[model samples]
Target: MARENKRKAAEKAEEGDEFTGREDKRPRKEKVQPSQIKNKEKRSAVYAKLKHEKQVEKRKKIKARDAAFKQAIELGEEPAQKMVPRTIENTREADETVIRPNDEEFLAGNDADEFSTVLKQQTVPKVLITTCRYNSSRGPAFIKELLSAIPNAHYYKRGTYELKKIVEYANNMEFTSVIVVHTNRREPDALLIIGLPDGPTAHFRLSNLVLRKDIKNHGNPTSHKPELVLNNFTTRLGNRIGRMIQSLFPQDPNFRGRRVVTFHNQRDFIFFRHHRYIFEVKEKKGDPKDKKSKALKEKTPKKVIARLQECGPRFTLKLVSLQHGTFDSKGGEFEWVHKADMDTSRRRFFI
Candidate 1:
């Protein structure tokens, strides 16, 4: 009986060991990173291999999609919808301030805004462009380009006068707007646009400046007022800023000049581009087998194509702040101010 008990005890111990072993399995293997590798050559080789594999996978997916599309065509069935890749712009967090098409309040506000007179053609826009008190080397060059770009814009020498005094003088002179180009370290770094009479001031951070001479094969802009194209200004603040920019130019645009000044806003950054477009006719040979082409002599077909030439001085602007009143730095009430903490998420945007 003692021997039987020992045998049963041995079986029970074995079962417990088996149960414990199942519960305490080996930990998962961690993924090895290229940065963790000590050898430079091996790290680089592994990284390249990984990149090649990813490219191959991408190509395979494209090929599969093409094959599926062709099969659908052959079978006379509806093709699968094209997949749109995910991007930050498409996946951005929803914003409540985006203006809708039939927003009556927004429309009314626009009609009664500070820029209404200029936009409505009641008053012509006379802009006064000036530099900071201590101007940089490139500031004057940028100002010269602005003078050409904006109609009836004059450059005033910023000597020892304060900005408040300048704003007062511009108001007295009937200037519709004041543009202060701030420079630092020999570069034009910021732009301050203040609407006159009644107030609303906008400050922008300027970057990626390319002058007229720097652009290759640039066309010279004419003295006629260029057409304005404002795109993607959908939010409340964006519309306000767009109106302010629109107020800098005259209401009527001379389409005959074929010059276009575009302020394209994407991801809250404004891109400024000037271009001269021309339409040209080009002859092309038609298909010989088609009945229409055969009747038209197959070689005399002409197509009109529109081409654009860059009229330079390109730059980008990001809104830093928008103040309710004019250039009173200490006492101004800001409608919106960009802060470091505001950039917590890549998918969040404000305009």
Candidate 2:
């Protein structure tokens, strides 16, 4: 112990004059000075400036487009097309009713053809429309528009009532179908269509909606107010629901004819319309000898009409594809779907 103490004493005595190879066991971090904060602010300022410039450039582009369109109208040239890029799939393709199969396609079998023919002759339907209480403000407007389009549609406000109970109520009331709106973030985002008495339930995403107010057709006002046009996403969904309801119509109509039901959705609100489509002459304006005809006498506007015959029951139908991801699960009645399913070739219906 004495020899060890003497060696330590010798090492301590030589520490001031000689180097010992040893690193500090713990190092202290440098204190952050106020200057570092200023440097960070400087970097962020540069980013902010860049972001502002980009936004200005985008606004300028939009203004230019509007001006160009106005100029074209004055020159009597073709109006400029708005080339706004879409971040998501849109409904332009689904705008037409061509997605529904023709009589020749699915009506090949004698039994199926007979059933369709019966449906065409006698179609009466009763439908129930339910709106999410969270979206009451917009829901009623949509409901009113649909009521005008469809006949014998009942409206209800969905509060704390559960889906099972609602379905039961629909069944007891003798409703052919139930349409439910589901809201998210104060916006109507999804739709649920279920056939009464244990039929498949379809859920769809509703987007790219254009209501009647949004369209400025001052020269031509449609009777359909708060009109809704569903996008491609909803059209594919509607295709499925249409087929299900089509099956429900019996092969033979009663003395009153065939009865059909439909549940359509747009902008997250469910619409009901149950009428057969028919052709009629479109409306005209002014006289056939008007001076406006002198500009282009060679061009004649052919009128077109897409009307409904009010066959049995008047209602609307719109619903779509089964997907795994839109947050759907195997057991739930509403399944989440993917965007790709909108274009699937196997879809039973279109728009």
Candidate 3:
């Protein structure tokens, strides 16, 4: 019995060894990369082949989706929902500062904010636009376009006057906001937006400025107040900034003018675009069976397609700092300031 047990144990050990040996002898597959090829021609060929394979796979997926959709239609069933591609904006890190639609506290706070009076239409928004002490020719041109864009906006030349003095003057003149365009090396590089009377000032780094004349086939702006569109201003700070900007324009827009001023924020950068839109009637030919049907069709409004023409002076703004009360560099309280450490993560965003 002892000898039989030993023999069985030995057999089991041999089987284990055999399994290990089998695993060891198995050929492992390694991923073949196009970069591994030393020959440039071969590398190019491999890259092309890989691209072709990807295209073929994509086509196959599309075909399969089409086939499934057709089958669902035939069976009078719901088609599969298309998958939404993940993007940086969609996958951003969750922020507590992001404002919710039903936040009573935020809503209440906003009602009594500095720009609240203007936003509520209690008072008209009067904006005073100015440049740095040392100005450039292009600065005036940009200010001219801004004048056309914003209603009740007036430009004042900055003739060696201090910003504090200008802010005081704006407050006295009952201006709701003050825009100070700062230029560096003859190029407009920064913008200072100061909310009048009380406080809350925002400093933005400006870039990618394109004037009205630079735009091809740009439309002329009318005196009518253009509609204001503020997009993606979701955070608490963003909301304040949005309100400040909104205060620059009138509450009521003249839709007849078909003019629009859009401030679209993406990746914490605000893009300014002015456009004039016109609706063109789309004519459709159809034969009515009877006079009544013809009369009904005629009563129906014609399909009008909207077309947009850019009214330029397009630029981008990146928020640098937001101060609580006006422009005081040395002794001012900051609400939010952009720091180098704040940009450690690409998915993280302030506004």
Candidate 2 C-alpha lDDT tens digits along 15-39: 7445665544557898544445467
Off by over 4 Å in 1: 1-77, 285-299
lDDT of model 1 at residue 238? 93
RMSD (CA, Å), each prediction: 8.5, 18.7, 9.0
lDDT of 3 by residue, 1-351 (tens): 999999999788779989877444547899889999999999999999999999999999999999999999999999999899999999999999999899999899998889889989999999999999899878888899999999899999889889999999999989999999999988899999999898889999999999999999999999999999999999998998999889889999999999999999999999999999988897565565545566676786668888999998899999999999999999999999999989889999888
Give Cα-based local distance difference scores for all models. 0.92, 0.52, 0.92
- In model 2, what is the error at residue 64, expressed in angstroms? 34
Work out the TM-score per prediction: 0.78, 0.40, 0.81
RMSD of 1: 8.5
Error of 1 at 34 (Å): 13
Per-residue lDDT for 187 in model 1? 99
Candidate 2 C-alpha error for residue 334, in Å: 9.2
Ranked candidates (TM-score, high to low): 3, 1, 2
